[model samples]
Target: MSALNTSVLRPAGFILMGFPGIEHLQHWLSIPFTVLYITALVGNSTIILVVKFEQHLHTPMYVFLSMLAFVDIGLCTAVLPKILEILWLNSKDISFEGCFIQMFFIYMFVTLESSILVMMAYDRYVAICNPLRYTTILSKTLVCKAFVAFFIRDLVLTGLIPTLASRLPYCSSVCISHCYCDHMAVAKLACTNIIMNNYYGLFVALSILGVDAIFVGFSYIMIFRAVLKLGSKGARLKALNTCGSHLFVIMYFYIISLFNYLVYRFGKDVPVHVHVVFGVLYLLIPPVLNPMVYAVRTKEIRHAFLRHFLPRKIDSDLSHR
Candidate 1:
């Protein structure tokens, strides 16, 4: 550790430049963002509540779905509040500790979500391909282990990012060019050598999300193969239908995330706002969309919603009429 690194360990703070060129637009942008945050909160919370109260949803698939919803809520809560503050109140100053803390939860939940997707893919694979053995394979004990393993893996692996970044001496400008405290965005502000940080970040991204994505892809391929082999067309369609929601979630999460990652890594010539906008989208869209996707695509979730809330809605409507 250099003397400069030690001196700047506790620098003043960082100023988050929400939107540089269109500062006025940030307030306008808050409208949609606020809508998204509320939608994500309400949508995911509904899923969690439904899964908890609905006895029929106690299967492995819905257990994993509930876990995904919980992670979505954590992910949105980690970034959206600070972003709203920056957009609405113009309060962008974040202490060094605060920035790293936010970065920690953001990475933690993102990786956890990735792991959950992989688990969901596996759940679908077993249910569709080896239906007779799905219960035995994805038993309650195994599901508990899966959750513990992924949570620990994410905490241990993704935790390195913030831990390493926090140690770096940020002797340069403290103005971050984005709304939230992204690891790379904060790393770019450091004056010292960040080659280790950059490389480690890439390694973590590939090892966690990359490996999980590969497994998910392989699982789906096997699933499709099995589905195609079924003698009855109705059987094939039914099997594939169960997987629709999980597949859409995988595509939605990875597309925005990969786009943002590629842009951050290689799209240097791209405009700054473009990077910031996509980064925000990557964080925002999946949480907002995940529960809705499941609610629309999965029959049981819809029925659970109706079973729990539809009667109340009907009664209220009749009273008003």
Candidate 2:
């Protein structure tokens, strides 16, 4: 019994199902997934490079934006390679250690993203509510400190879920039903009692995502209030416009995540493919859209992009003329 239990606890590996019910479609699905991965890589990398090289973009807001791009890159990179392999090559085997490592990084990147969003909200709040002190409040030193705080806070908090999960005695089937290593999904495969895992996962999810969302919402409310008190219509529009990208990002991240959580918790009757598809969407969509949202919606980013990419075209056109 003891040897049997040990063997069960430490299985060889897990088989990740890319898209369970639609195996035939995985090749087709890989096309879009590959496109999204490339887009996220190129887009976020461009943002980071722009923020790094452009002197005018050395401000706190752009600094945070660059950090967000960095996070998106990490988030997508953590999951996409394995996903693409599973989809395109049918290589779904992941060692237990590999699975835990992936789980850790995925959760870490997600937590960092949530923290960055909260910091962005605070940055906006300070900029709009106290423009005079904005520079003083979110100085380079403060931004550095905020970055450290975000890393440490999320590292400690979100790490708990994956850490506890890794320690669990997984005595059941060594198969995960989704593309990547989701904490809840993996934990659910344990044959032993998983009430602790479930409760703790819920706690961490709420503490990070739920609390961050509430704070972000509150920050926006304050921003709206400040905008309303502005005497001119143009001022209100300008303020709201500054927030448009961040607000859209916040909505995009949280809404899909919330829906995924709901389906995970309550949609047992729903089709497995639906859950898998939504899971993929939840992970992939933000990374693909975030940079686009910022670039298209933020005037500075648009200007920077145009300045970076259009000059060569313009010079070519001039030479032709």
Candidate 3:
């Protein structure tokens, strides 16, 4: 065998896939990203704390909501700090390994979040369609089993891409055209012909986003039908109210996801703002928005938020004084 090379594949120049001139505008981003980062951390984290802290939230809906919070936290951590550093410090530098790791967690957390939404849809369907059998249908045992299965499936699907990615020979243009290590963007720069890789990535992407979209669609159909059967305009509105929050959050993510892939992946000459802003929003916005939607739109989570965290806030101020 030939001698093994030991050089680390850190890119030489500004090979970032984001908006350029961060050096000039980077200062402006600090305040906004800092505020966003902190808000997302506190909000998403509170969702988790509330669900776990309150006894009333020991049901399937809250369990998956907690899982959604967990996913939000993970995705936020995966993308935000590096982005903040790049923006604030004028450093668009990320090593290949760091990029790879970030890509893995981003994909994994995204998959988990999507799966949790699927679970939530199912939970909503049962609650609305089979009220008497909700608990029996979604028991602790069944939920645990489903969680385990979802976790494993997400882990496997996302992990496969990174494994394949690590082995590919990448060109020196380490400029990933997005803020994070979007698999498609990275794949585009690989020196090797990536038919199989593209196929696999497409399969996995469609599987998570596509399949979940279908599930959400079908569930809503059944839900709407059931609501029609009830024959109460008020009940129909309430049923729709229960769904609006998730619908907005889901539509936003998928639309951005489709836009990212379509504009960058298919169409060349992607704008810099699309890379920096859209990529950041792709991961962080949902976390920030999802919790707000849950708190403001969904009553139970709002009450749980009040019960678990509100008094702590009151006590903290009292203690500080």
lDDT comparison, 1 vs 2, better candidate:
1
Which stretches of candidate 1 lie above 4 Å from their native place? 1-9, 234-245, 312-321
Residue-by-residue lDDT tens digits, candidate 1, 73-93? 999899999999998888999
lDDT of 3: 0.77
In the range 1-321, model 2's lDDT, one tens digit per residue, is 999888789787898988889888999999999999999999999999888878999998898889999999999899999999998889999998899999899889888888898988999899889999998998889888878987898898778877888888887788899999988789888877888887777777787888889999999999999888999999888877767666887877887776676677778898888888887786788888888877567878877776787878757867999
lDDT for model 2 comes to 0.85
Query: What are the models' TM-scores?
Result: 0.92, 0.92, 0.87
> How good is model 3 by TM-score?
0.87
lDDT of each: 0.87, 0.85, 0.77
Error of 1 at 160 (Å): 1.0
Candidate number of the best lDDT: 1
User: How are the candidates ranked when ordered by TM-score, highest leading?
Assistant: 2, 1, 3
The stretch of ten residues in a row with the least summed lDDT in candidate 2 is: 257-266
